[model samples]
Target: MSKPPATILASVKQTASVIFLHGLGDVGASWLEAFNTYRIPKAVPHVKFIFPNAPIQRVTLNMGMPMPTWFDIHGLDQNAKEDQPGIEKSSKYLSDLIEEEIKGGISPERIMVGGFSMGGAVAIHAALTSPHTLGGVLALSTWLPLSTTFPKALISGDKKVNLPILQCHGDQDSMVQVQWARLTEQGIKAMGFKQYTFKEYRNMEHSSCNEEMEDVSKFIVQNLPKVD
Candidate 1:
């Protein structure tokens, strides 16, 4: 029997515009509460949301415990990388999910891709390198992975597209170093990314904050392509 395709949880309305990928271990359902509590109320009339779960893998931080992850952690003492087959598969899976969303009446320009932690890295990588330029990208406490094509994408310029990205990280985040976030922001800006937003919340840990989420809402409303 063929394996079942990964499921993505969506909001009540077909207003699906933004697609969210969750961090390691946490399921897509974990995002629903945040969406309902924060993003839904400020919902732009036609903007819908999608949360896709990463496949299961062995996480280094969790004592090599096998859980849902976009890529393998490899070793506890090492950093995150996208060199493994699982990582590539997960990336392609995310790409396919975006394609599916497009076929369901959501234009690439109308779709925003985002996530927390590891999910954030995946979203950022996929959005930056994808053939189609997404509407916007929200990466919360996420960093740029090592195996990205940012250099080529940089030299290519924003010819085919220019996307606005919203990235947030915590100064007190122990999981992903705060400096990495800064590096990601600096690198993207240097690469001719004129429309990117970065936020570093003081004293916050490795999770989302009300203010950051609020900024996300504003950014989403602001950057969405104006429909005629």
Candidate 2:
């Protein structure tokens, strides 16, 4: 099924892009509003922001309920069964989006993919499995989706192993807990992606805070600086 186009915040002199994904049950515009709240768009006027909407799908975790989800989540625990096909489908979609940006003249090194929770999981998968090297990936309060398949996935996919990564989590995150982020941090390192940083926010739950957004802004500009 064809979903709506992303909520775009095009730059006047666009040279770089940050294709960010929102959390489950969230529209791109909602995170677009969050970016506005944090002045992320203002922080980097040269960077075009593309927030794509996830297709509605059934989530087993939610009792077979359908919502705007990139993939179906079986459960919240780390050992829970993963929907590989669903995740890979979204990964391909995201990689295609990145390819489109590259075809439009933005270099691979000038593009980033990011998301929250489930979307963050997709971002990590799509970015790592992509054949091209990219600017970076912002994985917020999310874990590595198919952890058991890593290194193997990395080997067979002919993936890009080198790129900066920023992973942030909340110590008080009730939805996606802090331990999962820790495991993901270790998982990312074990997979040979060394340029990753894990930041923890105090007193923050399963949501964004001003400090976290500020860090995100810094990451975007630092990786995709003004080229104009």
Candidate 3:
């Protein structure tokens, strides 16, 4: 499959790039509003933002109804069986996006991958399996899918990812329970993933908040490559 068309916010010089994936049911264009709503363009003017749309697919948890999802969610249980094939496919697509950015002149270390909810799950998977160490990864309001196999996958990779990771979740997230996010943190840490930060927002739910956006902006600024 070809790379999905993206909604891009180009920087003046395009020194760095962020490939952000939207959650299920969302189109890439919707994140343009998010960028403006959060004033991300103003905060990080040197970095480009790329939001890619997921291919429409049937989700089992959604009663097999079709939706734009990176992978199918069979069940919401913590240990529910994951859609490994779907995740791998999406991860490869994400890697292709990263490679494209690299080809466009951004260094692999200057590119970050991130997403929300289901998108975040794929972002984590891509980052873990990528041969090149990236700027970082942002997993927001997301849990670790295929948790049992992720550690082995990381170990089998050609290089270990030492980049910083910023994981944020809502304390009141009913869709992806905060407990599951904590478990994901524990799982990654057990695999010796250093430089991971887990931030919890009070009174928030299964969505992004102003405070979270502010923190994300800070993370972007911190991790972006410094122009010499």
Candidate 4:
């Protein structure tokens, strides 16, 4: 029997309001450093950060090595499109976790979801597809997933969700390519979707930079559910 692909590591802090999804081949625990430094103590100080691990699965590209992945990489070989099953399944798992958080007293308006790499892509999908609007969605070095629409198209009749999204990508990213990010932003805007902010870093690779994290921290602080 195969193990489930996703697991949520709730923070010791009961007041956590932020959740993080780690990328392919990485575990959720790996992001603790950034969350503690950039996201936790500074931005959403009282917010608890939930780090959810993607499921371990046989990746088509990595010689079928079972690694943490939200979706298959086969489509990545075909111009970075996403596989529907993997994307949808992963989004459901993440959404379920978010709902549990809500039950624990964190309102949708007070919760923020973000991720890195494939995890970032999953974050984007979950945020848009979720029934409730969120405080914000932070996508780092990621792209839109399969079966997704932008601002207005994503909203149904009276289903308006004015979600502020933050997109950051590395200009020197060889894996995902900077152009993908640019094209995604353009496509969303062209479709009449707004309320998104994008930042592109020069000479950066597939990983997050301190400056980028710093900028993200500030954005969270400024946009998060304000305290009384």
Best by lDDT: 2
lDDT of 1 by residue, 1-228 (tens): 012333334334544477788888887878857877785534565666667766676777578888888887754223544445655566667778789888987778778888898888888777876777778889899887753566674323564237888889999998887988998888777776768888999999999889998898888778773454
Overlapping backbone residue pairs in candidate 1 total: 3
**Each candidate's clash count:** 3, 0, 0, 6
TM-score of 2: 0.94
| Cα TM-score per model | 0.85, 0.94, 0.94, 0.86
Ranking by TM-score: 2, 3, 4, 1
Checking candidate 2 for backbone clashes, the offending pairs are none
Q: Please, what are the lDDT tens digits per residue for candidate 4 over residues 3-65? A: 433333432444546777888898777787766656444445566667777767888878888
Instruction: Please give, for residues 1-228, the per-residue lDDT of candidate 3 as tens digits.
Output: 424656555556778999999998888778767877888877777788888889989999999999888988888777677899999999999999999989999998899999999999999989888878899999999977778786777743444547689999999999999999999999878877777899999999999899999999889989994585
Task: List candidate 3 segments past 4 Å from native.
Answer: 1-4, 155-161
Q: Write down the RMSD of all candidates, one decimal each.
A: 3.3, 1.9, 1.8, 3.4
How many clashes does the backbone of model 2 have? 0
After superposition, candidate 2 runs with Cα above 4 Å error:
155-161
What lDDT score goes with residue 87 in model 4? Answer: 79
Q: Looking at candidate 4, what is the lDDT of residue 16?
A: 45
- Model 3 TM-score, all chains together: 0.94
The CA lDDT of each predicted structure is: 0.74, 0.87, 0.86, 0.74
- Once fitted onto the true fold, the runs of candidate 4 whose alpha carbons sit more than 4 angstroms away are 1-16, 75-81, 147-161
Pairs that clash in candidate 1: 15-48, 16-48, 17-48
